[model samples]
Target chain A: MRSVLPVLTIVAFILGFWTLAVVPMNIHLAADQAARGDMVVEPDDARARQEVGAFALALGNPAVIPMTYTLDRPRLPGPQQVVVELWNTVFAVAPTSNRSLIYHGWVTLSATLLGFGMGTALGIALAVGIVFSRTMDLSVMPWAIASQTIPILALAPMIIVVMGALGIQGLLPKAIISAYLSFFPVVVGMVKGLRSPDAMQLDLLRTYSAGPAQGFWKLRLPASVPYLFASLKIGISASLVGAIVGELPTGARAGFGARMLVGDQYGQPLVTWAALFAAAITAAALVGLFAALERVTLKRMGMAA
Target chain B: MVSVDGNPQGLEHSAKTARSAVISASSVDLTFQTNDGPVHALKDVSLDIEKGDFVSFIGPSGCGKTTFLRCIAGLETPTGGALSVNGMTPDEARRARAYGYVFQAAGLYPWRTIGGNVKLPLEIMGYSKAEQEARVRRVLELVDLAGFARKYPWQLSGGMQQRASIARALAFDADILLMDEPFGALDEIVRDHLNEQLLQLWARTEKTIGFVTHSIPEAVYLSTKIVVMSPRPGRIADVIESTLPRERPLDIRDSPEFIAIAHRVRDGLRAGHADD
Candidate 1:
């Protein structure tokens, strides 16, 4: 409480100052649009231009949106309007209506869940393969890293096009993208964690006449829990990235990414920002859930969280 | 699993019903293939360990003390030698799980509780679950770690971890116990305390022990017979019989007899490693 107090106050102060600066400008712009008899002003139409224009014109920058423009051309949505719109979408429409926030969120959430699961499984299997084989370490590890070097931005469109040609339309490309992104960290982390049991620990197991499988199940796998969870956190976040990427290919008509795209087309910056925040919040919650699960499970197994 | 105290296993390299040496190493030589060259770790050494003797090996670094222990435990096979435990080869003896090895660093599995670590050998050796639990409890008591059975290794102090390791060794009741500097990392106070406890424990169990250490006082204090070793060809220099009594306490160090033995061990160590 004490640590966050001053920070909260500073944040509140910045927010207050920002509202003061922008709300009046929004009102002036709305007033000017009203004066011009125009009904709707695209949020992006004059955004960059207005800033430069205000600087250039210098006088009666009273062209400030809130105080001067017509009602439709309110230079920007005030923070309160954005919040109200966001709140309505989240609390009101999301929980109700057939075409709702939950409905759209489910589309992205399904992709994320499927992707995360596939990625984690594949990652663990690959890690096991890499750790157990010298040839795999020399070969597969480098290739896994190389696969990620190409930006997801480039990969997503190519995946969609290729996948569409193959008559594999839905879910597969998104999952593959997420798995592609998520598996690298899991493989790297699990390999390091699995191999963390040094020569002495291996020798100890050998002294027991433990077989290779026995040694792994009894020692190495348990030792790798912390690393696994750490990788899972990374993997889950990457799953969100893949879900959004899946949206970029054909400008998806649903999901948060789709919402943002629609908002951009309609010059609704407030809606776009709202969707981006939702996606971020969803990702944080997913990661947090995994963290809680890790703590409970690994702690029971006597591993450090 | 019954105690063989009445007819204690003795040392004899001959054909007889369980009458031969419990452990025999004749003309043993070990060479590790290193990047530099073949490290001549042990050279043409021979020794026999009786079933109920406190034997300690004192040597400099790279003097094959650990290698010898490993060989006996079947962790390392001798390059050239006829090594046997109860007339069987080291590999066969290991298949039978004939020895309990305690490494220098305790080597307790960090994920296991102290009691669970002690139970590991018994579990591997196919003890009944109840018997394993009983034996784990009994050994934890022997090492004075009865209350710490539930605690993980990292929770314990270094001395306590070592004692827990000793409990692990003792838990399975193996015929032989091989210790490689088991108390080497502890300070004087904990080492002395553990030494006394170990002597008492030795008196009680009478298990044949092959201990490896570099410290002169540690050599003189716990050993009944000390094998001094030299490096750079790694062979036994001398095997001196310690004249101390079986019941040694912490106060035994102040005694003139203990000091004389300490001096002799010091000289033996110097004579042993001086060539290196």
Candidate 2:
């Protein structure tokens, strides 16, 4: 309860700030809406309203301040607007409906999970190779580091186009981009983990005349678990971002990215804000799941204090 | 034991002793080439460790005691001269799994229980499931850690963790044991208790043991043969065969013979530093 209070306070603070900011951001639109009604509005012409600053318009027509929060197609949706949209899109409709955020969420989540799995596996394999072989350590590590520097946004469209040409349409292209983004952290982290054993530890194994495979399975692999989990948390979030970005540029007509694009094109700010918040919530949940798994696994392994 | 004096006669004498020795090192030198220049870690270091001998290599840091121990365990290679373990080259003997080595630190894998850590070498050696269990049980009992097998290393104290490490080393039933300052990190009270337990373990096992340490009383109390070493082109300063009986108690360290041996080790260490 003590821990939860701080989080609640911060969340409340953000909501309060958002509620205050909505008045100025949506005031111009509210003024026009109010002017159409029997309510009073200063500089009632729509073009004059556009020319005037939002804060100035709100000051000119104080009666329009209350209507700002209720405006349709608000420039900056209020927190309550986003919350209602989220409730309607996520819970009010069937999951299979195009209007439901759950349907879109599942689309993005499937690609994220698939890509994360592929990326983690490839990263671990590469880390093992780099650790055991001098050639791979020298050759592959530089390339892996270099791969992350290329903007995923720039590369995602190219991957979609290339894969689309090969008749690979829906999830695989997005998953591949997710895999590409997610693998670097795992590679770097797992490499550090695999090499964490000190000189004495390695010497003890050498004294036993333990082979490389035995050394890896017995010592290196166990030592790397904490490191691997740390990377995995970072990797999963990166994978989610990759899945969303992969939806962008390709005009992939589903997932959080598509919802965001649709909301943006149709001028439904509440829809875009709701999708954005849902994506944030999903990323937090994914990371939280890994953190819980890490706690349990490390505790079972006696690594956690 | 034959003393190495850098003479033809001394060389011949060591050659004769090497025949019956379990570990034989003749003029073994190791020069580590750093950016500064060649730093001689060992120089003409000769020693003959017979079967069932509890030998301790005592000296200051950088005196090549641990290096020499590592050479015997095949964890290090001498730049010059021949060293053999069990009638085979050190590397070949290592492959044959001739020795069990205990390092300075406990170095238990935090992810493994005490039993799992002890079972590591046995698993690597491909001992059968039944034999592995039996050996782990036996060795844990030998180290007085029988009941604590399920406990993790972090759950144990430093002394207990080190004891578990010893149990791990002993699980494979090797005929030779190499230790590098195995109790260096412990408190004196715990160190003394472990030293007593180690002597008992050594007596029961009767394995040819090579231990490295800088502590005067520890070297005197634990070793049947103490090789006092000197630094700066590390070489043997003295090799004192203990006159104390095999059945030693903790109080035996206070005896005249034990003090005499410790005095000799102290003197040898001082003499090594005289030239510095």
Evaluated with DockQ, which candidate comes out highest?
2
* Candidate 2 Cα deviation (angstroms), residue A265: 0.8
User: Could you give the CAPRI-style class of model 1?
Assistant: acceptable
Off by over 4 Å in 2: A1-3, B1-19
User: Model 1, stretches more than 4 Å misplaced?
Assistant: A1-81, A94-99, A165-167, A298-305, B1-20
| Number of the top TM-score candidate | 2
Candidate 1 residue lDDT tens string, B1-276:
111123233112112313545788888999999999998999988876666778899888988888888888788989998899867888787777777778889878777899888987777667999999899989999889989989988789999999998888788757788899998889988998898899888888888889999888888789877888888888887766666677888777788977876777677678866665
Task: List, residue by residue over A218-298, the lDDT tens digit for candidate 1.
Answer: 778988888999999999999988987888667777777788787778887677767777788899899989989998877
lDDT at position A234, candidate 2: 99
**What is the C-alpha lDDT profile of model 2 across A129-199, one tens digit per residue?**
99999999999999998998899889999999999999999999999999998998999999999999999
Q: State the displacement of the C-alpha of residue B165, model 2, in Å, after optimal TM-score superposition.
A: 0.9
The lDDT per prediction is: 0.78, 0.90
Best candidate (score: lDDT): 2
DockQ (CA atoms), all models: 0.42, 0.78
